[model samples]
Target chain A: MSNTRMIELIGVQKSFGTLQVLKDISLTVDKGAVVALIGPSGSGKSTLLRSINLLTVPNSGYIRVGDHAMDFSSTQTLPRDRDLAAFRARTGMVFQGFNLFPHMTVEQNVMEGPVTVLGTPKAEARELALALLAKVGLADKAGMRPDSLSGGQKQRVAIARALAMKPDVMLFDEATSALDPELVGEVLAVIRSLAAEGMTMLLVTHEMAFARDVADRVVFMRDGCVVEEGDARQVIEQPSHPATQAFLSHFHNGLA
Target chain B: MQYQWDFGFLLQYKALIGVGVLYTIGFTIATAVSGLVVGCLVALLRLSHLRAATWVVTAFIEVFRCTPVLVQLVWCYYALPMLTGLELTPATAAFLTLTLYGASFYGEIIRGGIISVDLGQWDAGRALGMRRSQLMRRVVLPQALRRMVPPLVNQTVLQLKNTSLLSVLAVPDLLYQGQLITSASYRPLETYTMIAVIYFAILFPLTRLAHRLEARPGH
Candidate 1:
């Protein structure tokens, strides 16, 4: 493992019954780097993102964060509920659907994780939540419920909720896929600013332009394995792999 | 036909009607409040993670739902005291039967409310690191209750009508009192009409309120 690497995976494998979803996936994320995973639907982009937080455990893999390696496949290994819980505190994830608690006000949704997960005092958590909402430019909508917000604003609140935990690394699992076309740009801009601020991110996104513009590196995947990996500029233009070349050509020219 | 309808006899027994309406109103309110508490607890148990608790609550719901309220009322009023050697007056038996009957119906209503809530709400609560109890209190139940309002009002109306059945236990509720008045005055048509009018007055406003709540946005 490199000294500056924030996440390291070795021979990570996952399966659903007899069907394999992730096959011998090994990757490294350097500190403060944005890595974009892009591929066709059902190519395991979301699975790869979820596996980092153990939301979807791998069948056989060694996942290392900072200096700690948590083995997911061992039947004998036991990580207590609290231990797994504490581990999740360091990673923030934004879902495709903007899964805000409908019962809570926008401000309460952001404050929830800090107070419940981290046991921060209510007053302190409230302050931190407000600051995060301000960062996403949703401070004025704090008193409203998520149902009242536009799609773009809801996604921003979801982003603020994830950031409230003060995570070291953030994962975006197709965060803009469910949004309307016009709403996509606002969410993308917020994510772009996070990258500019040196936040480590692993995004599973369909936005080719975003991957090209903001990602330090891009991994092109097919059949649950990365077929081509390189700098975003090289992969998006002048790709070496036939799969990558064919996939990109389809979207660019309306011919698959 | 009733000896020229004996309109003055109707006027004479008006006090009895007033007291009867009070008893009916009091019983309905008390039972509805207690039934809500019973229903919520049983619903939670029915959805319990433990198999034993789930089975127990499921059996309870099934038994109460399938049996007629009349039979249950009679059993509670007559058989319970014999079996347990604990004597209860007619009012106590009527209250217990109402509580049990209302609970089963309300349990179904509450379960439907909980299920109608979006699945993502549960996932969001888990992601926020809320415990099962906290998730229910802060996220799931609030949304469920909001969705439950109309159905709860319907259940309460049904319960108010069901209170008339308690007359069999000689609880001196509205219908029982009405029967006593009619027997003395021999004016069933006039007495029953008054009782019906009183029930309409209580239920109509609640029905309208439920409709108004349902019409609101995000309801």
Candidate 2:
């Protein structure tokens, strides 16, 4: 990889009423690199992931993806809903809860964005949806509803739905956290395959082993800020920040 | 005792009673359709994030739902004329009253249905780049409507029976038609019994239809 930045955030801030969530955070994600964001619950890991897609626009920030710049502080707004929608289409999000449409089949859920948002032909979208479902190892269950599927299967379908959008960047917000321990492996395996395919992925995960094994760089976050970041092995073996040391020790002692 | 269970009276007034039956059907259909439209809009308003809009819808629903349908009919038929200073036909007043009554109850039903849909559906739609309108159309409404169907059918049937209250407004619906025949022929028991049977004839098929719909796969 040439280390060209696919996503950049500078001076990002977000607050919900009186409480500040993300405070002047900045990060850069290189093209074809898997950046894992690991932190305790409520540490703004998910908030940062959402900010990248403008799902939760930062209170003040300059966010650039590829060539497009979305500055929340700018007085002038994006022209129309269409402009914001187009930007969103380029950045797909996989939610922590597998938010599959229960009324729709796995194939239909995957096909929805391609057909409705992208305006692809129904037949073409269906073919692509089936292919995506197969990629996620749910080809046999394409016709089943989300209510029938296990949590892992539902998350895989959610991933397929996002992949069907053909996004330039995929953001996973603790995507495997909702799954059972045994089921998490299959979902992580699919994600690992995507990483091998050179997909630019931003994953916020609590699965330390998967992060250690799959992430090119693991960023340890605490108190709504990045405490440390480096190669997965080095970060796991050697930590410079006191916060990182405390966090790792807690987990290692089976107290987390 | 000789006047008891007079099939001859029923047979004699069949034409008049038939017209009454038609009025009941027409009123039921009109009110139910209008109520569904008003109810859905009101439900959307009530569920809106804005406090003012939700309050307005909440007050409207509360006022209508808490009051009696007969009183509402009287108010629409009599009170509205004095307030608005506009003359309305009995049919118009009765229709408006029935619509509003059904709207309030159906609004509650719709709100419940929308709330019952999993929050995950909304998240899925948002993550898929679906705007609010698309999310409502493609995900929320479909699922919500599925959940609303059984209660909606029950409401429709209730509105059908409630059309009897329109007789007081002189809309010449089934009950009024029954009253017309009964007074002229001096057959109260016979006329009202026939009226009851006619109401059953209309509601029975509707109940069956609702049952079949509820038994379907998605619902």
Candidate 3:
């Protein structure tokens, strides 16, 4: 991974009514880097990740992804829909739920972003979709509807759909969390291959082992604040903060 | 003295019955098509971010839905011309009333179907950088349309049934021609019974089609 900063967040904060979800969060990710965000349920990892694409607009903060940037605190009005869409096109996201368009076939699901957003020609988008499906190991299932696929297969198609846009970065919000235990491995394997190919990614995950194995950095958050962050192996294996250690203990006990 | 049933008198009125049936079918098709178009527009307005448009559309839908179709027909034919200062033929008034009435229900059904689509689908579309219109056309509507079919078909059947009220406006629909036949032959029993039978023929197939659509797997 290069040292050039790809994503930077400065004092990003978000609140919903009386509750503050993200508290002045600041972090940086380099090009080709994979960062795993590990935390408790209400730690705001997903919200933080979502804010990158302006999916959940932050109450106040500045987020810059490559050339596109948003300073939420500077403007009285929110960013224009056009600007938001342009910024979002830079990154791809995979939800816990596969969220495939049920009415579309697997190939159509993958081709949708390219054909609709990028305005790619249908024949070209079809080729790209086929290649993506093959990459995700679902080439034969192109014509099948999402309902007919297993959870693992659906998640892979979701991955392919996101990849069709040729995004600069990817966000995985507990992508494998909804899958059965056996199915989780296959989804993770696809993610692992992406990491090896040097795709920049930020993942909010409960998978501690995978975090240490695949992520270049691991950020531990709790109560809407970053508790500790460092090298993936160091943060996961030997956490310095009491909250981080306490959080890791639960996973250790569960695994045992 | 037992009364004798004269079944053969209706044969002479077949031309009148044919014209009535044609008018009934024509009104149903015209109103249904126009109503669906208006309904889609209403649903889109309701779903839009504009508060005033939403309020106006909501009021329009409620006004049409709360009042009876017969009252709407009478009002459109007799009352609307006075209010708007435009003369309307009986057929025109009947068409206008039925279209607006059907649109109210169609709009609600369409809105419900759209909102019923999972929120995650919206998220997925937004994440891919699709505009709201693009998302609706590419992702949301295709899925929503499947769930909307049975209800829409059901509403269309109701639309056809509503056309029966058109006879009060002298629009020459089946029931209106039946009245003519009754007055001419002095045989209300056979004429009205035949009218009901014709209505049954038209509506039965539509209802059955709706049921079949509803029963289809994976809906």
Candidate 4:
């Protein structure tokens, strides 16, 4: 693993019973690189994204992020809970449903990771949380509960919550897929800003235009395998693979 | 011929009835608290990955739930001493039986509440690098506690009513004192009517509180 490689997966394979979801998947993400993973519905995009943080543990694989590494095939016992938690603490994840803690205020939700996991003092965590919330354009919503926010506002809070952990890499699994068409822009704007700040991110997104504009590279997966991967503009505008061409045809007219 | 109603004789036994009321309320509060603690432990055990612990807790819940509270009180008071060779006073036996009986139902209610929280919420917490205990304390319990309030209150109310069965064990609860009043005064109608009134007075408000909690918005 090179110093520039922020995330590396080697011969990762995951299966659910008889059906394999990730087939010998090997990919590398460089530091400060934004990779957009796009594909059809059942193409294992979300599973692959979730595997990075060990949320959906692969059947047999090697996954390394930063200094933490786990090889599922080599170990008789699964990684200890403490080790897994420590590893996951290094990566931030945002979900499609905006799974914000409904019981806590937006500010508390953002402060939770730092105060609980990192053991940062409450006052310092509060300041950091406020800054993150402000960055997400939710400064006024600090005291409000998540259930009170709109889909767009909730997603922004979710983003702020994840970013509060100061993770090395951010994983967004269909972050904007569950939002209203009108609400998509606000969330996409936050992600776009994160990319501009050179945050290493892997996004499983259906937003073709947003991916084309913000991603440094595009990876196309189908049936648990990457069919095509190249420069974002090159792959989106002029595909070398026939499968990529067919997939891009559907979104051609919808591209903005 | 008209039956003349007389409530005047009961005034002489006011002090005794007052003591009975205090005993009943005390038992309810003590047992409710103990039951809740035991229930939480039971629920956690059931939720754990340990197959043996889960089976043991499930059996405990089933035994208490399937048997009648009256039978449980009798068995604890009478049969328990025979098996364990430790004699128990009426109050001790009643308290023990009620606490365990209440725990069985409370455990199920608490487990249901915890599981009712969305799977995504657990994922969200896990993704943030929270351990299972941290997720339960910081994420799952806070939300589950809201949905648990009404049922928990309702269960406590049932517990209060169940205290009436303590009379069979010769415990000096409200209903036991009422039986004494009936035998002494030879006025079963008035004594039973007054007992019913007192129970209603205590339970009506609690049931109302439960309803209000159930109707409360944003749960």
Candidate 5:
């Protein structure tokens, strides 16, 4: 029974000046569902993921994440400090570039969110950070700086940092896109493990095989609109919409 | 005519030069600390989104950068005491003037350092739910501080040497001590030469340190 909604966005609309990035969109992910959002370049997949965390605010929307609901519309009282913080704490994000704080050790990068935002005591935060590093297979490298790590390892540390906040939902925006081809497997392994553990996650990715295997739901978007969505096998294997077929054909044709 | 190189006078006047060294070192330390602190505050304000504050900081930086430090020091000595009704000593006036002047240069250097950091770093921190202030302290400031170090040391070295201008007020600094010895002992060459050597001695090491800092790029 899909009893709980981990994330829900209704009638979300976002535009940058005259360029609309998300056009009247509604999406929902149930608790423990792994949703993979796939699209061609300029299809607004990244922008849509960012809006769920309010990293990019939708011009008009009703966003419900776990327990907090925010309305972004004219005449509404905008989110206050505590409201924004509460909203953000519910969502954790991993980026395309693996933006770890270079001056900090891997452990410190992971500990930052808990200590500063959640006010977790230092000793406890350190312990949690170490454990998360181990989970990402970087516990041995926890004392090292981000600049010293490989791109894949740095991305893993970023994953640990976001997870340290114990967020209700995790967002990945092309998290593996910046890694070397050989380095991609390690990061993908970590995400595959997260999916196995039933973490409610929304990932924007280009790896067709990995998305087909790991995601329970596959959402295909093009030109700022949801073109097709269904069970992962159906959408990835038997796409019906002309736009979705063209997009997947392009991906399989080495255009990714 | 044979010119005499006299080493004897320095031995007799070592105590005067000692006092001068103490004063110069004191001014450098005081100015470096106070100027750096105030400069950081000003840089923060200038980089802030407050439009009026940015304009005010722009005027402040330009005025200080455009004018001569010597003129500013003289003004602090002569005009400030009369206007504020506070009895001013020359040493205090010079310190205050030098610090304010140094702050402007330091502010510009720090602003450059801040601007040099990657915008992607800011976005990354915010994506992880960090507030703007948290992102700055945790992510941005650390990288910027590394870039600021060489320029900061250069400013300090300049301030240390600039303190010699205090000699114009007959302040007990190295140049003033040299002048007093020149008048009393009738040995301008020995006194001024000693002062020049001392200035070079202090500044050369700092110059080399700046080069070393420049050599070590970001890790």
Candidate 6:
């Protein structure tokens, strides 16, 4: 497999008013690598994942994903809206809420990105959307509205919608966190298959076992910074940092 | 002699009433189309990040909505010609007032509809690499427009009724034509009753349609 830097964030910082969400964050993911970000709620894991696509631009930092790059501190070289749109196309985001255009059918939701952003022809986009929906195991539901889908099914469609763009990297912000316990499995299975196929993904997830199994590396975050990171097995099973150990204890006790 | 009934005279005035009805319907449709266009522009300006532009639109809506539509019609019909030295026919002045008046309400309804959409929808659009305009045209407008249907229909009915204000300017709208017939034939009771019936005939169905739209938001 050809390996190059797929994503890089250097000295990235984000704040909403006085509350800093991402503080001096620096990370890099090689092409085709999956990095799982695990943390307690409000620890900024999701914020960091969102910043990858400039969904929430950092207050100050340098970010580079593929050919797109931005130095937030520079006054003159700020990326234009078109540049940001192109960059976001390169790094697709799947939200926890699904956020599918409710007025559209499942097929339209899946095909929307390509038709509008890439200007792909209707026939080609339709074919790709159907294939992606099939990949997510919801090919039969393509004609239905988002309101009719199960929570897990909606998230899967959202994943397929993001994938339809054929992005260079995918970001999932707690994709399965909102699903009913019974429904979580189906969505995870699809994500697991994506991992198995060597898709580059960065996910903020609460499903510790799924992360450990699927992610090549896990980064534990606390209070807007990465406290620890290593190979997924080493980090999740035996942590060297006290913050990581403390955070894992809650999950360990609950699961055990 | 029982004050001789005069339903017979209306037969002679049917052409006038026909032209009047035509003008009424024409004014309503014209106001609606132009109002929608103006409303969208003002609504976008109100929602924009520009503080000064939003304040100006806010003032415009506030001014239109606070006063009676009569005040606006009178101003456009009377004061505007003096101040701007621009001449307008009485019917055109009525059209101008009705359009601006309807636009203020339309702008509010549109702004409300757009704001009510789930905030997460914007995130979905942005994440997909769509531009701001594409996001609005494709995602946000479709959902927002569905929700806006009831309010928009309600505004249309109200606007239709407000067109009667044109009678004051003697623009030969339905009410003005009825007044002319009543004066010429001295059959005020029958003439005004017929006018009332005609107004109800035009507007009652529209009100019912608005009710139906309100009841079934999915439509």
Per-model root-mean-square deviation over C-alphas: 3.8, 2.7, 2.1, 1.8, 3.1, 2.3
For candidate 5, lDDT tens digit of each residue in A153-217? 99999999999989898999999999899999999999999988889999999988888889999
On residues B33-151, what C-alpha lDDT tens digit does candidate 5 reach at each position?
A: 98998899889999987899999988988888899888898888998878999877998888888888899999999999999988878767776677777778888998998889999
User: Over the stretch A19-100, how does candidate 4's per-residue lDDT look in tens digits?
Assistant: 9999989999999999999999999999999999999988888999988899998766778888888889999999999889
The lDDT leader among the candidates is 4
Docking class of 3: medium
lDDT per model vs. reference: 0.85, 0.86, 0.92, 0.94, 0.88, 0.90
Query: How far is A136's C-alpha from truth in model 4 (Å)?
Result: 1.5
Decide which is better by DockQ, 2 or 4. Answer: 4
- What lDDT is reached at residue A149 by model 4? 95
What's each prediction's TM-score? 0.84, 0.93, 0.95, 0.96, 0.89, 0.95
Residue B144 in model 3: shift from native, Å?
0.7
Cα DockQ of the candidate 2 complex = 0.53
**Error of model 4, residue A53, in angstroms:** 1.1
User: What is the iRMSD of the candidate numbered 3?
Assistant: 0.8
In TM-score terms, which candidate is top?
4
All DockQ scores: 0.30, 0.53, 0.76, 0.76, 0.43, 0.81
The superposed Cα distance between candidate 4 and the true structure at residue B55, in angstroms, equals 1.8
lDDT of 1 by residue, B23-92 (tens): 9999999999999999988888877677998888888888988999999999998999999998989999
Per-residue CA lDDT of model 2 for B137-213, tens digit only, reads 99899989887999999999999999998889888889999889978988788778878988898899999988887
- Give the residue spans of candidate 2 off by over 4 A: A1-3, A75-83, A253-256, B1-3, B215-219
- Could you give candidate 2's per-residue lDDT for residues A22-63 as a string of tens digits? 988889889898999987788888898988877776788788
* Span of 10 residues, lowest total lDDT, candidate 2 chain A: A75-84
Please identify model 4 stretches exceeding 4 Å from their true place. B217-219
Residue range B1-219, candidate 3, lDDT tens digits: 987877788999999999999999999999999999999999999998899999999999999999999999999999989999999999889989999999999999999999999999999999999887888898899889888999999999888888889988999999899998898889998888888899899989988888887875565
Q: Which candidate ranks first by DockQ, i.e. highest?
A: 6
The 10-residue segment with the lowest total lDDT in model 6 chain B: B210-219
By TM-score: ranked, best first: 4, 3, 6, 2, 5, 1
Model 3, span A94-124: residue lDDT tens: 9999899888899999999999999999999
- Model 5's alpha-carbon lDDT is 0.88
Better by lDDT, candidate 6 or 1: 6
lDDT of 3: 0.92
